[model samples]
Target: MRNRLNRRVAAAASAGIGMTLLLAACGADAIESGGDASGGSDGGVDTSAGIDCAPYEEFGEIDGTTVSLYTSILAPEDQPYIDAFAPFTECTGVTVNYEGSAEFEAQLLVRVQGGNPPDIALFPQPGLLQTIVRDTGSVVPAPDAVEAAVDEFYGPDWKQYGTVDDEFYAAPNSANVKSFVWYSPSAFEEAGYEVPETWDDMLALSDQIVADNPGGEVKPWCAGIGSGDATGWTATDWMEDVMLRTAGADVYDQWVNHEIPFNDPAVATALETVGGILKNEDYVNGGIGGVQSIASTTFQDGGLPVLDGSCFMHRQASFYAANWPEGTEVAEDGDVFAFYLPPIEESAGEPILGAGEFVGAFADRPEVQAFQLYMTSSDFINLRAQGGQFIPPHSELDTANLTNPIDTLSAELLTSEDTTFRFDASDLMPGAVGAGSFWTEMTAWIAEDKADAEVLDAIEASWPQ
Candidate 1:
């Protein structure tokens, strides 16, 4: 059934109608669902769409090749990427097999070291990519064509994210705007509240919410750092967001790379700033309870209180829209929406906190290289955008193609000429610190009510030597 769908979609693409059609018009072809994927003969190529194959043609014909891709994007989110690449398969008669999982980071390392790896893998953090590059040296660098496309389509900063040892080894695929706080617009209007324009204003608004509580029982902010084994990630995000605003990007980078100690006074200062909110018994865990409850509330349910008017704000990423109740409207005037977490007036520059995934290949086969290059190309980017919920790093993306207003705004912020964007700091740190101790220690500070200085000290002590 999927093969027939792909054939129909390929026909539509060849006829130049696929780019503007709905997602169902180009249902993603699942290579794994087909029988004996490796036994397929070359399907006919379709150039009727008038797609300029000039850029991809140099990789030579790879009519029967099958390329496997592994990623952390998972199920529904991964489908859009597969659909975006359908034209690649249609043009070259190559099958792109894709698998997504929550354990991509650990499993990818195991696969590479065990002498078996996918043709390509998408990395959510460059630090993990660096570890694999430095340790196994098994990953393939981006082809010249891919590098050139990245240079032409994305900002230099994004290119830097994918480079290791000064070699371009990966290409950014998807991105998320992280510095946002969700709130109920109608509730804000009913309570005569306005969006805070700066960090100080945000705090002042928090105080106002507390003051207006009928019995002084309602808090102003809600948060959750609980995410199972990855529990304290949300708290780490607060520190990173505050660090960019309080300590500036240079020092933030130093902290991530350990050029500055994790226990440095600047780091301490950021922790305290986070404490002003997360550690304040009056500021968090609205539906969940006091500050301690933040550690128990699942991250998925963290922001829900805002919808019930128990909390005024919930700091989270743009992708948190998925956590909202189905059929709930999410927009500036809808049930709930987000605003960029306002910048601090004292910061060195306006920095936006964000995260994204990078595409890297384990084999340099022509088919693998062709798919890699195509993944970041403008055509792939445009099609993915049309398929919905994709924010490509390509500087030239047409924001209008993004289906959601929030997503379009995120794209605007990321590509704005004056905005200096930084990837998630913890994600860029050594896993022992970024994914391990940092998560555990932050949870201790919130759950055990540990002192700020003590928590920082513990994390600094845990930094991998």
Candidate 2:
């Protein structure tokens, strides 16, 4: 707790947000400084009064070693990760060089197959991680210390994400809640409507919104899957959310691995379920044009209509907070907020669909191993959380320190014992099917009014033969 307090003080100073006031906001009782505040050569960097380096001592002085990291998390979001591990360098003399790219998924495979993998790579999808492990046999397993930390800090479900051929190789680093419906609280209040708690209630509320606005001048939902080259990714998220609710996790898992065909009856049902909301002209592209307008509307602008009363709900992930107009307050009681999308009545359980990053290594050098251990530590995770926009999967995270209400809500959902969690399945399938066919076909279905079965069949046929 003392270390976390000191990190916040440091962060506040860095951000120019007045340390004293920030401390007061986060309820930090005191700040502790250690000897030689400028940091010492023996100790990598100046740390809080009592942060122990004994756990990392076994690696035995690899200060000159430079460990490279590659990831899809680009600056400035990636800088927090670099800052979180600065202490590791100060303590052990190992240099951590991180490189992030928008082209991470495509570039990562090329690098590995070309025999140029980084010392460590942060993968946004376990499916991609597994592919590298299977194809190149280059990924190093997490050292025993890191594995133990995984056991102590994270839930069992997280381990499965990093395991390949029964060997634990990576740990989930950050997470985001994907099953949220964003809306304006003031709009709901003025319309005399309550946040729905079930799939049935959600549809009924959508119906009521249309009936309340007879001329169809207003609509119940606004949506977009257009994201430049990543255009139809949002549609894929919708299918995964519905699949989790309607087909259950076990079936979802099978479908992800192609244990079941991509166009199975269950998948068809999930696609149609999404269509009920997205294809219904009365429920989609509000403030824009008809349902066809969604394909041209950028995903970043899809949810903005909620604030203007042109749309009632926008289904998006927690990180969509970044897209809300600059001055908007996204509090539970503020003008706009998000609610957990409800489950289908016949669903097996309340399954939460989300996404996160995993840390995988290509080298097993002692400094590399030591860095991996430190990166996944509870202390480092909490420090990253304080930087905001970073959500740790650690069950031990102090949610009170997480300043964003949306982040806190995501943490609460992730930590709940009863909530079943599943990674975004589209990201878990073979890239040919997951990224290529799935994304392309979904966009065609929405933009061109293609048949659901035809879209699903194209995706199924495109699965790597």
How much lDDT does candidate 2 score? 0.75
**Residues 247-288, candidate 1, lDDT per residue (tens digit)?**
998988899889999999999989988899998877776767
Model 1 lDDT on a 0 to 1 scale: 0.74
Query: How far in Å is the alpha carbon of 165 misplaced in model 1?
Result: 1.0
Error of 2 at 330 (Å): 1.9
Report the number of clashing residue pairs per model: 1, 5
TM-score of 1: 0.82
lDDT of 1 at 307: 89
What candidate 1 gets wrong by more than 4 Å, as runs, is 1-57, 60-64, 214-218, 415-418
Candidate 2, residue 346: how far the Cα is off, in Å:
3.2
443 Cα displacement, candidate 2 (Å): 2.3
Cα lDDT tens digits for candidate 2, 1-465:
223322332233123221110000000001111121123322121234334577788988786878888876643355456666676777777777767655566778889899999899888777778878988899999999999998888777778888998999998787678888999988999999988877899999999999998888789999877665557878888999999999999999899879999889999999999999999988877888898888888777788889889899999887776567667887766878888887884554777788878889999999889888887776676667765555776766665446667766665555444567777887778766666788899999999999999998899899877
